[model samples]
Every structure is written in C-alpha cells, then in structure tokens.
Target: MMITNNPPVLNDTAILNIARDVLDIESTALSELKAQLDENFVHAVRTILSCKGRLVVSGMGKSGHIARKIAATFASTGTPSFFVHPGEASHGDLGMITEDDVMLALSNSGKSDELMAILPFLKRYGTRLIAMTGDSTSPMAKLADVHLLVKVNKEACPMNLAPTASTTAALALGDALAVALLKLHGFNEEDFARSHPGGALGKRLLTYVRDVMRTGDEIPSVVLGSSLTTALLEISRKRMGMTAVVDETQKVLGILTDGDVRRLFEKDVDVRTLVIDDAMHRAPHTISPDALAVSAVQLLDTHHINQVLVTDEQGVLLGALNVHDLFAAKVM
Candidate 1:
C-alpha cells in the first residue's frame, strides 16, 4: 500500500454542504440547551452573585479554551473572573483560589481526571463549585453545588470523537450566564466602558466635549458688532474655519463660517461693510461642555457642518471644536 501526498478535491457545493451540516448541528445543540434551562441556571446565577470574591473558571483541553473566553467575558461585563487550568491547580496555582471565590468548572464528560483531583481541595476549602457538563449524573455534576447541563446530542465531527458541538454549547451557555448576571447587577454601558478603556467604546463613553474642545484664547470669536472682516480675520487666525459672534458678555449670539463668507461673496456683496451679525447664522448648532465627544460628531455629521460652538445652558460660549479635532482624539 502506498500513501500519496495529493489533497482531496472538493467542489464549492460539497464544501458548502459540509459547512451547513456543522452549523446545523451546533444550532440544534444550542436549541436543546435553551430548552433545558430551568431553576438550575437560576441557582448558578445566584451562586455567582452571592460570591464575595472573583469567579475562578477551571478546565482542561478544548474546554479550557472556552473557559478562558468565558472568564474574559465575565471580567469585562461585571463579574470579576479569571481562568485557571485544573492541571496547574495541583501545583502552587491552587493558591489563587480563595474561600470566598466560586469555581466554574467545564468538562464535557464531567469526569476529567485533572478536575477530579481538585474537587477534594475545593470542598475542603469551602469553595462553591458550579459544574458545566454534558452528563448530569457524572461525579463532578453530582458533587457540584449547582449543575449547568450543556449536553449535546452528538459532536459535529464526523468521527464524533473530537469536542465540537459540546464546546460551542459550553461557550453559548457561558455567554448566557454572563449576560444574565450583567442585567441582574445593572451593569450599564458606562460600567462596561470603564473596564474596556482602550477600545472604541471607551472613546465614545469616556471622551467628553471638555476633553477635546478648544478653550479660552484658542476659541475663534468676534463681538456681535464686529465687522465681517473682523470675524473673517478671527476665523483665519484660529484656523477653525469659523468664528463665534458673541455679545460683550461672551454669550453666543450667532456663528459665522467660511461657507457663510463664501455665500456673502457669491451674492456679490461687499463683506467689509457688513457686520458679523448680518452674515452669521443665529440658530447655530451648539453642544454642551459635558456632552460626549461622540455626540459632537453626530451633531456635526447631522447638520452637515464642519465645526460647532460649545456653550452652557445660558448660551455662553465656552469652547469650540471641529471634525478634525474629533478625528485627532480618535472619537471619529
């Protein structure tokens, strides 16, 4: 018998059929998990919520990969959690687990030898165990304070030997638990933003108008009685492409932009003779100093304007910002 290195040829239809079969199997498994949800899930959620210390998620093999992701989700959402390998737990790593902590163990068969090794220690330390397993009758499940059944009809693998559908089921169940805890704890977007400070979500939630807007002398402005030429000079000097027309008290009366100047020129009107108020838009778009920078982006995009004035409730001009500023701040 000779073994060749040639690869097997597969048509697009055949490839698509195989992909669909895998998806169908996983989808069915998820449906089964959904139908199996009962008071046991509620008990698991209650156990996690009641825990004073962080959640310690442990697993081995493919289940360990899912465990790490699930721990990440829990940590980012609201519940503080970290992953621990059961094999490593037998070593000094078990010191990471505390009495107040709750253990979420994942195993398809609920009988992983490595996991079983830590069961006695977990019990002796009074650490609550929440088991996610396929077999509710298995030793881990029987010993668990709360059992989350992630049983699947079969693996998506052709040989039904590798962990496929079971892992998917575990991941989805973990997500479900995390989301439920998030809702119960009233973990809003701001809380989530705090945990994820370096992402786009943080930029949107944490970056405020005051943080990015130009203040004091940086703001381009001209008095209400100032001439169009004076406003134009301010706009050019500040390079904001616009200037605020304000009263003596520094209250925003109107806004004059390069576009307004262009319109004045298009009408063949001599801008030098016109006052700033004559060419200014009285109903200028304004944002609060406390508003999110993302809101400013929306205002500029919605009004199709390049820049907007930042003002207080009484219409006092405090700062100014342009689309370029938002882009520089990564809020755009």
Candidate 2:
C-alpha cells in the first residue's frame, strides 16, 4: 500500500453525499438479506440449541473481525461461543473443537483458502458446521450442515472491492441469530449481567441494597423518644438528609427528613415546641437489604423521595441509601 503525501482537494458536499450513499446501500442490502431467511435459519438455531459443547466461530480477513464480534455476542448472550482463526486452527487450534461442538464459519466469497483447509477436519471430527457466505454453490456453503446466505446486491464501496454492505449484512445476521438463540434459551437481563458484571447494565441488575447502603454508625438514625433537635443533628452529621426513628428494640417507628421540617416551617409552626414523634412521618417507604439496588432507585422515584431506609423482615432498620449512594453505585 502506497501512502499519498499529496491528497485530493477537500469537497465537503461530495463527502456528505458519499456518506449518505454508503448508508443507503448498506440499508438496502440488509432489507434484501431479511427477505432471504428460511427453514435453514431455523435448522441452524435448533442445531446450536442441541449443541452440547461450545460454538467455535472461524473466518479470514475482514470476515474474521465480524466473526469475532459475533462470537462475543453469542458468549455474552449465554451461547458459550468463541472465535478461532481458521489459519491458527489449521495449525493446532482445531484441537479446541470437539465432536460435541458446533463450528460457524464466515467467508463472504465462500472460498477462503484458510477456512477451506479446516472444513474436512471438522467433518471427520463429527463437529457440525454452519457456513455464512454469499454463494450457495460455493465449497464452504456445500460442506456446511446449515448454510446461511448473506449475499448482498452490491458492496457499499464504489469500486465494489472493499467489504462494506456485505459486512454490515453479516453483522446484522449474527445479531439476529444471537437474539433468536437468547430468546429460545430463556436468557434474560440477569443472565446477561452475569456475563458482563463489569458493565453498567450488570451493575444496575446485580447490585443489591446491602451492597451500596450505609450501615452501623455510618447510617443516620435516631431512637424513639429523641427530640426533633436530636434527629436533625443526626441528619446533619451523617449528611443523608434524613434519620430513621427506631424503637428500643431497633424496630422502625417512623422517619424524620429535612423535607418534613420544611413543611412544618411552611405552616409557620413554632419549631421549639415540636417533638420528634410529632414531626416524623409515621410511615416511611422502606426496602429489603437483599432487594436489587435498581429496585431501591425505582422505589425512591415512585415515592418522589431522595432517600430510603433498608429494613429487615421485622421492620428493623439495617441500612440506609440516598440518591447519591445509588449514583455512586451506578445503579441510577
């Protein structure tokens, strides 16, 4: 490849037009690809579901990148799949494929020499092969147990040499397969969360109230019989904007919040004459420490409150959480 030190003059209008044309071409390619789905697709899904071992995806060149992404999608969605380079597999990585496993090979032209070299070995090994390609009559397609035709009308590249629309169509088809398998396998958000525990979705779905709540002395709380002034002091010291009012046995009796104090002042009541029992809300929204953090967030949203108490089955305050706590946990 030769680097051009002197490039052509910039044409902003032409660049934007070319961008639109590229999208239009890829969009049409996907539409045509959708119309081509058939029973072979069904057979492919069933084949994967019946697979007792991992799915091994293999490809060459640009299709290899698409294969890697498809493999990742399948793995994250509970299919237990991974990508293996056909070139590498021909050397010794083919050992990763077992008789119980299924192999999905990607090759747009269906004639990549590297992928072609491994098909015979997979056949003798009894590993099922599913080929995604553009030509049904190609060797890779003919050798596959299930052939998924991803043939596009034309490449998005004006020269029709670079992979553009074909790759997009292949990627979309991979998503379709992963989603279909996900539905059939009964994989849910929690399952996805387990596979992606470091991601935002995992944090939202997996984190519990106990995981993010402030406990022990760190929690802002006051006992029953405490004066309104005492409760306010606890709230200010803990900086949670609220204090749990608990009985002698630590059972929740009520809750006192800054917003409640504001309401009292709004009515022009004498603050000095107020007691904790008189000022506190008799019933406060509470959640279990074991509940999902997202549930706590929703509880606060539903009640239009910024803070919530975490309680045990007997209504004993175990911990506390505010909007900031949820934000820190990234559950919001």
Q: Taking the candidates one at a time, how many backbone clashes does each contain?
A: 0, 0
Candidate 2: stretches off by over 4 Å: 3-10, 223-225, 263-268
lDDT (C-alpha) at residue 119 in model 2: 89
What is the C-alpha lDDT profile of model 2 across 163-281, one tens digit per residue? 99999999999999999999999999899999999999999999999999999998888888788888878889999999999988888999999999899889998877767889888
Model 2: colliding residue pairs:
none
Count of clashes in candidate 2: 0
lDDT, candidate 2, residue 265? Answer: 86
Q: Across residues 1-332, which tens digit of lDDT does each residue of candidate 1 receive?
A: 78778867999999999999999999999999999999999999999999999999989999999999999999999999999999989987999999999999999999999999997789889999999999999999999999999999989998998999999999999999999999999999889999989999888899999999999999999998898888889999999999998898999989999998898899999887989878898988999999999999999989899999999999999999999999999989
- The per-residue C-alpha lDDT of model 2 at residue 295 equals 97
Cα RMSD to native, each candidate? 1.9, 2.1
Which 10-residue span in candidate 2 carries the lowest summed lDDT?
Answer: 3-12
User: How do the predictions measure up, each by TM-score?
Assistant: 0.96, 0.92
